[model samples]
Target: MGILDGKNILVAGVTMHTSIGYKVAELAQQEGATVIVSNFGRAMSLTGRVIKRLDPVPALIELDVTDDEHLAGLADTLREHVDHLDGVVHSIAFANPETALGGRFLQTSWPDVGQAVHVSAYSLVALAMACRPLLGRGSSIVGMTFDATVSWPFYDWMGVAKAALESANRYLARYLGPDGVRSNLISAGPIDTLAKKAIPGTEEFNRVWGERAPLGWSTTDSVPAAKGVLSLLSDYFPATTGEIIHVDGGLHATGS
Candidate 1:
């Protein structure tokens, strides 16, 4: 039997087939979990088309984390598909191009910075709070993060957002722990995703990871990170919470 058999999982932020969220959903299905994807507006149609590729096509639900109406309706929308969720993956992140790239850290506007933090970092808290009613003991919440401890060339405000995400993970863990629900993040290396293409200097970071990381790196493959996410969602990491698991080909541990 697959490790996640009978589990119901809600995964968000699947924009394209190559997205890490897509890979996680695919693997979660393969491991016997019943997966439901969350997207909103234009993205819902895209996810609807993409999920057809799975053996048992999963349901798609609307969830715009920034919208209070959507957040208020999340648990109810999810209940229509499954009674409750065993796990939820927060894979959504975005920033205005101006705030994200081209060395605009000093010049980025307050609104742009707030937008970045809201979507990339605060959404995790928003998602957890929205989905908590559907989750219970043994349930896990996972989010995607980059190595936020250091700065990157063109990462700028998104880097700051990630740091906030890391901090949020800890607080979520602390508050949710009493309820037996776990919160964690997977700090993945640069992978060739549509989101990565938007960052101006991701190629350089990918190259550095390939050279400096002990396990080398694969910008084309997200399966390793996907596998790590599934492990956390499964019974394997029952006691783990508020942890940042690095699936970066050992880059985070190595010195440049």
Candidate 2:
């Protein structure tokens, strides 16, 4: 049986086939998990089309984490898919164009910065709590993150958002650990996904990533990273809460 043979996983942030969410959900199914996908405002149609690409198309539910009405109904929404959930992959992230690129820290207005942190960071905690009741022992909450150890040009507010995500993940683990709910972050390297392409200076980031990562780099295939998520979803990481798994080909450890 696959590592996740009996796991019930909820994956968020699947707006397109090119998104990391697509690969995560696809891999989860291959690894024997019953997967459910979450769609946000305006992307519901695209999410539906993407589901068909999965081996056994997973159910889709509304989860615009930024919207209270949607958040309140998320449990009921997913009830249409499965009775309970064992894992959650928080792949959701967003920042206004103004806050993401062609932007500087000083130029970012509070509303823009606020939105960045809210949807990109705070939402993880909100989702974990929202799904807590459904999660029993051995359940997990996985969120995506960037190294963000250093400031990245053109990343502006989004970088700030990632930093918050990293911190929030730890806090979630601390609180949820008592309940047997594990929380962790995957610090992925520069990927060429649509999200990365939208940011300015992506070419520069790609160059640096390729040069620094010993295993080089690739955004074309997120299957390996998807597997890492699967590992966390399984019992393999029994004591791995609040940890940051680097799926960037060891770039996070490179000094040169």
Candidate 3:
């Protein structure tokens, strides 16, 4: 039997077939869970195309993380497809090119930083709150994060944004814990996705990770990280919440 058999899940941030979010949705279904997807604006069309790739193509919901109306109406909209969610996968994050690459951390504007944090960090809270009505006992919320404990070359303000996301993950766990809702993050090693392509110096980042990580690393393979997400979303992590599980090939524990 599949680990997630009979569970209902909402997966957000799928923009391409290579997207981690897309892989989550693909695997969730393969594991016998029903999946619903969400994307926004121009990405909506892209997600629609990617949805065609899934075995039982799921429904797509509109979710512009920055839009108050969208966040406010999220649960209600999701209700149209699935009555409730047993798990929520938040594989969403973004930063303006200037805030992410170009080594402009010192000169990065507040507006850019604000945009990054809002979408990449605070959106976690927003998503949790909107999906609150659907999440209940034994429900899980899993998100993706880059290792934010240390600054990486060219990551810049986006690094700051990821740190905020890590902090937010903890807070969400505390607030949602009473209701039995669990929140966690997977700090994955660099994987080749459409989003990673936008980063300026990912090649060197990948090379360094491969060299330094004890288990080695594969930028083209997302299955291992995707499996990590599935584990958290399943009943396997019953007592775990507000935790950052690093699926970085043991890189986070390394000194060099």
The best candidate in terms of lDDT: 1
The worst-scoring run of ten residues by lDDT in candidate 2 lies at 97-106
Give the per-residue lDDT of model 1 (tens digit) for 1-256: 8889999999988878899999999999999999999889887888889888877888888899999999998999999999999999999998887565658889898889999999999999999999989999999999999999999888999999999999999999999999999999999999899888988767888779979999888899999999999999999999999999999999888887
Which residue pairs collide, candidate 1?
A: none
Work out candidate 1's RMSD over C-alphas: 0.8
Residues 1-256, candidate 3: write the lDDT tens digits. 8999999999989999888888899999999999999999998998998899888989999899889999889988998998989999998888888554658788888888889899999999998898999998999999999999888988888889899999999999998999999999999999999988898877878888979999999898888899999999999999999999999899899887
After superposition, which runs of candidate 2 have C-alpha atoms over 4 Å from their true positions?
none
Candidate 3, run of 10 with poorest lDDT: 96-105
Each prediction's Cα lDDT score? Answer: 0.92, 0.86, 0.91
* Clashing pairs counted in every model: 0, 0, 0
Q: Candidate 2, residues 51-112: lDDT per residue as tens digits?
A: 99888988888788888787777877777778889999999888887455545678778888
Clashes in predicted model 1: 0
**Model 2 pairs in collision:** none
